[model samples]
Target: MALSHASLSLISMIFLAGSIVMLFFVILSGVTSTSPLSQTYFLRADTHGISGARAISQWTYFRICGDGNTDCSASYADPPVGYAWDGNPNNAPAELAGGHGGDTTSSSYFFMWRFGWVFYLIGLFFEVLTFGSGFLALCSRLGSAVSGLLSLISLVFLTVGVSLMTATFVKMRNAFVADGRDASVGTYAFGFSWGAWTALLISTILFCIGRHSNKADVPSSGRRWGRRSRSTRSHRSYEGRRVKEEYP
Candidate 1:
């Protein structure tokens, strides 16, 4: 079925809204341990007997929580991997326990998490901009082009963020398992993170398609007008010839 400009705009808006909502949930994961919402976390593991570490630790974007997010520490941006162990090198996993004196986490782990967190925020910012520009898509191809550009930017940021987040946590989980501790990934967090990226991708493609479709319509309409004008001119010439014949 062919989609009109209005239909494409509306669908794109819907997908963009969904992506925004999913990203919000991912960001807010460990704010509280309230029912299903608390299930949203990147990684969870048993860290029993570790100094300054919770018996059950759940890591989110802002804060690290305990016992399925029931108890959370103060929230902050770009939370360090060492936050899980109170920055105690002795309490953290071997891979994360930095060699330098007084260092709680390895340089790789620290920077990976920090960059991932920053990227998430950047992606969200661009997504908001795209949403704002998307409103004009119904009326103008320029608007669709702008929205598509913004969405593409958002997608790049999100793709990097999600990849880093996944790698950091997957390695963390493996480290915990190797240390004879139980660890697992949070299903809700995994789903939402990737889901948001998928939605934004679809929205971006739709915007681009809408812009091209509108552009195609213009030339077709012009061609139709050209044909109509030629036909009208021919009819007039034929009528003049008939009049001249009758008079002569």
Candidate 2:
């Protein structure tokens, strides 16, 4: 049972590691949620030079990226403008087009890949929860199968976390690469730093621990036998009682 649990945790952590790596590159596709690209980033509309923090998801003509020029509309938009702001008229607010695609200047709209940070944080939280619950339980008498189930769940979520963070990192890196140092602060919010790697390592460790514990929990697997033994004892007692009653 313990070995099975350990196996679950180990596999989960391993999966998390792979996911985080994949996410790093995947996030680089979209734009970061930092200050507008100053007429940079995303597939801008062709009408004006205004920067649209719209869907950076598309890599096509107007959907690819243009700096508000005749060739590509000089904005990160298409025939229709998709702002990371309140570009929608019906829902447009007095402070629409304030950037980051929300009604208020400070507000944020999470279109396609607008706010990668939010998802990254959410992923982090779920990872932490899964890690916390099963970390210690790995070596305990917990059923290995249960641990394996949890590890599998954790691995799935770990992929989400890595993908989200990677997406955010990619956007940030692209913004920097496109605009240069003058446009953005040297470091991206979703950075490729020691801390990020450390997080991955920790998640991986927890996963292994969970899997390793699974292999040792053999007793848990024998519950059926234990139940049968108890039932037999009960039957014996009932028979003895019947015999006593007959003698009396």
Candidate 3:
């Protein structure tokens, strides 16, 4: 069975709301000391030798936190590509030491996270625009088309952002493990990032479907109106002829 325009709009709004919530949580991770949220992070690793570094560190979007999210560092717009440790480069892992052909703190790593952060903000902005326009989708075909276009744009930005984030952390985790350090990825951050993307994708698709359905209904409605007009005109002509004959 085909869903009406209103029904599709409602479902799309629900998915868009879910996407917004997931993105908010991901962005706010490590910004506070609250349970569950505070625990959220991208990568966790044992960094034992570097000075000014915790024995175990969890990297979040805005800052690095010590084990169990205690003693978090000051937040930044674009977090340092390195672990923000201060000490002899030799004590740090080869992947992060940066003095002798290391990757961490390099221009490549720095730009990756920086651009990824920017993309996330951009994606969220467009998603909000899509949601606001979605209300019109319930009644107007143009509204559905506009909302779908905005959602597609949001999805593109989010895809790039999440891909960069995943690549950055996955490589960092692998580097730590290669150095015989325990490393793990954060489940909440990973799940939320992808989950939000999935929801936005679905919302975009539903908006398109609703738009097309509205278009399909127009011609049939016009045909029905045409047929009713023709029958009414013919009935009026017959009544006129009968009156003329009786009067003559």
- Predicted structure with the largest TM-score when compared to the true one: 1
Q: Give the TM-score of candidate 2.
A: 0.34
Cα lDDT tens digits, model 2, 136-216, are: 545553533343444455445545543543453345334434543212211322243224445555555555455454233
RMSD of each candidate relative to the true structure: 3.3, 12.6, 4.1
- For candidate 1, what's the RMSD? 3.3
What stretches of model 1 exceed 4 Å from their correct place? 99-102, 215-248
TM-score of 3: 0.85
**Candidate 3 local lDDT, 140-198, one digit each (tens):** 88899999999999999999999999988898889888888899999999899999999
- lDDT of model 1 at position 108: 85
Error of model 3, residue 21, in angstroms:
0.4
Among all candidates shown, the one with the greatest lDDT:
1
Candidate order by decreasing lDDT = 1, 3, 2
Q: How do the predictions measure up, each by TM-score?
A: 0.88, 0.34, 0.85
- Over 4 Å off, model 3: 99-104, 215-248
Worst 10 residues of 2 by lDDT: 181-190
State the local distance difference test value for candidate 3. Answer: 0.85
Ranking by TM-score: 1, 3, 2
158: Cα error in model 2, Å: 4.1
lDDT for each of the candidates? 0.86, 0.40, 0.85
lDDT of 3 at 43: 89
For candidate 1, the per-residue lDDT at 205 reads 93
Residues 78-172 of candidate 1 have per-residue lDDT tens digits of 87777777555455578877633236677888888888889988999999999999999878888888888999999999999999999999998
